[model samples]
Target chain A: MDFTPQELLIASITRMLRGLNHVAVGASSPIPGAAALAARRLSDGHLRVSVLGSRKNNFFTDGGRELFDCAAQGRIDAFFLGGGQIDGQANINLVGTGGYPRTDVRWPGSFGSAYLYFLVPRVILFREEHTPRVFVPKVDFISAPGVSEPNVYRPGGPYALLTGKALFAFDKARQRFRLETVHPGFSVADVEASTGFEFDRTAHVDVTPAPEPELLALLRGPVRDEVAETYPQFAATVMCGSDDKENRV
Target chain B: MAEHGPIVSLDALAAQVPDGALLAVPPDYSGVAMEATRALIRRGVKRLHLVAVPTSGLQAELLIGAGCVETIEAAAITLGEAGPAPRFSAAVKSGAVHIRDATCPAIHAAFQAAEKGIPFMPLRGIIGTDMLRYRTDWRTIQNPLAEGDDPIVLLPAIQPDIALFHVPLADREGNVWIGRRRELVTMAHAAKRTLVTAETIQEQSLLEDERLAAGVIPALYVSAIAEAERGAWPIGLEGRYEPDAAHIADYVRTARSEDGFRAYLAQHVLAGRRAA
Candidate 1:
């Protein structure tokens, strides 16, 4: 069965979350929430998922609350975060387009990214676009850093980068991002052509699988339905699909 | 000074509250706020309207265990338990508390409208949602002066009789300073009378810091102040001690059954009663 890129991305995230003990998802975060829910139900509730911003106190009888507060209590082992601009070193800048205070374009800034990035151990960065604007050589602002340069590690750093065409992981030994895997329909050349800077790419690169039938069903059914009902803008985006297919910018 | 009003203890503040009186609490379930809630329940208050972001499993358990509050209404419910717990499910079914998903803006607007001596405010985005139903005071009033548009629903301001908050520091005069979370600002601005519970009573100079001073709840608005250590017991402060897991677990267990909740309340809150 042929799957769309978004489906593949959701499937990959669901797979990664399945391996973790717990997951912390943020408010208005459709991808992470869907992935976590999928992991929990598919994995027989083994995946402990917690969602933030869905409740007042961290403890409620709602599904979103159960998932988020659990993650906050260190119950979550992994967390998924979305980035607007990410650098080669896995530094994420959700604050603005460029430097802090002054920037080319300004985003909403990091809402819960600062706290969530600091606390969560393994933060998987996901973005629908994979272009120079997003997957930049260096981010404009240091909203969250994957790894500190030469100084002591500060708060709000991303750990991994998951893009539309490729996947990147932080190489602790070299203190840089390395090409971990590429998508099924894309090649090394395709990835390099889209990215702004050069990356260390070994001969071997794994392929990200397409979404299984079950995953596709889940995404289109409960996931899409819930998001559409709750958040209208996000739902519009989901229905419209990414702006660019070949180079998701 | 009226015998200091019997020196309200940390555990007995709730009992001091009058029945049918509106009570406003902080958004998050910090330990101090939780302790205050436990106290309020012991006072035998009948109706509770929590000004919170949403409810969590632990909080639901706590409310259920209190057994005093007959009806509860809040913005949302956060499920804290892993998977579905029978006890937690039962609480929702019992209709003791009704959960609604309304944002802080709606809550703030409601309070602001009340404070300004207005009836209601016309809020956008929540038109077709369940919030309209939950907030029955909301009404669809026609724009009589308009040419040809449909009527708009106006949300009535929710002016609670009392607003109680816990913070990191406070002055003797009841001025409060919350470090990171500014949720208390909404409650303080919206409520009729604001009460504060703090970890420490700091010198007035602590408010000199430009950043910290901005978040201070002024003495003019605050009615009462108390200093208590580990006051936010079961729920921890941001940079402070962790939540009491044992207490949370006990709350979960005790709140599971009505009989268990009554017994738990008797032992923890009522039994050790001191003069109030």
Candidate 2:
């Protein structure tokens, strides 16, 4: 069976968010959008997914306030965030790689990750590029820190980080990231070579499960359409064509 | 007819803006009053406190480049998919203006606090970052309401002197249809006054139609209204038209250097090519 790397990641994230009540995907999160859409379809509409850019999917009438208000009130269960650089402590740098006032590289400054990371219970940190530059020892600027002190009124933080190479679950108590699984066709060594930060490496990491035929069908058909409304470019590019799937078999 | 009604010209409305005013503007995607921005630049406004609520784009860049802004408080400023906003990046890097780097919700919450007439609003995250370290205004306090001594970040309320934005339509009665872009409404409520530029002027009250009524920002909040067709040009008016991508691309290209930026200003803005 041949599947896209995105499908593998989508399946892994969907597995993590088994019974969430509601998930909101913001800005330019196509993969997370697909996974949320997939999870919603899998649960027979038990899950409510809101893609911010989509006119049809977004339920917010009051601009950014509705999203924030909902999150503050604990109505939103999960949200997806990405960064220019994500470190070992789950600290994300959306601003840039070097010193923020004047940086070597300037990514788009942090949009809502700093705010969303605090309110949403399950914050899934997703970045496709797995490299030393992105996975740093210490981010030049902390757009949003992964962990908060005991006294801080934080209901949410990083639950897991999904990269192109591996998935790591964040342990808030210890403020450490534990490598849960390495994607199939990739090894711990591959992760080690590319990553800049040190983390708790597990001895026996499970291979991320591939999307089965049923899941693939759902992803290609309904999930693709649902995601297309918000991420037309992503859906058009990433969704596995039926002809390609038939040929693969 | 409506007793010193809201209808006014861009310059007349822009003239009302006092020196060193804290002005709130909309994001790039929404109705950004480019006409008003040009007028502000031409007026040689000084030491302006420009607030983007959460995020901004070319408007922030344009103002920063034109030297009309003295302080910028925004979560982030980018050209969105078009790429990094060069002028804003250079301004921050060069330490041209005082930059208060904040998160999106923090900005939103600050405005919200002002809208609610509160002193400050408590937020959830960024207690551990360097961004928090530099912010003199933000303070961390333990949750008094919660059972345990939980800490929370408190953002000071932002009360802008003027809230300026563009709209697709405004009635003679001064009401403007903001539709689902209620952030404009929030800006209006938070600011002392709101100035609007509508693409078209509606003769009938927008409140007459139930559908349009719901989106109307009542005349009471609006200080002045200007009829400027394609007012948000270069930046889109949302549903009215797509952003003039070619012109914006040119802005990105020209905004790279001081000389290029001057040329850009003289050619487009100083020429008053699109002035309404």
lDDT of 1 by residue, B1-276 (tens): 232532245644554456766766654443246556656665566655554433333444455445444444444333232122233344445544443334434554566577677988764323333234445666766655667654555767777777776677876545687654555665666777776667777656446778777767677677676666666666666566655546656655665567776676677666653232
Kindly list the per-residue Cα lDDT of model 1 for residues A89-116, writing each as its tens digit: 7766654454323334534334334334
After superposition, the stretches of candidate 1 with alpha carbons farther than 4 Å from their true spots are: A1-249, B1-16, B29-32, B53-61, B79-92, B95-104, B130-135, B141-152, B266-276
Give the residue spans of candidate 2 off by over 4 A.
A215-229, A232-249, B1-4, B42-44, B144-148, B244-267
- Cα error, residue A189 of model 2, in Å, equals 0.8
lDDT (0-100) at residue A184 of candidate 2?
82
Q: Candidate 2 DockQ score?
A: 0.55
lDDT of each: 0.58, 0.84
Binned by DockQ into CAPRI classes (incorrect, acceptable, medium, high), candidate 2 is medium
DockQ of all candidates, in order? 0.03, 0.55
Residue B133, candidate 2: how far off, in angstroms? 1.2
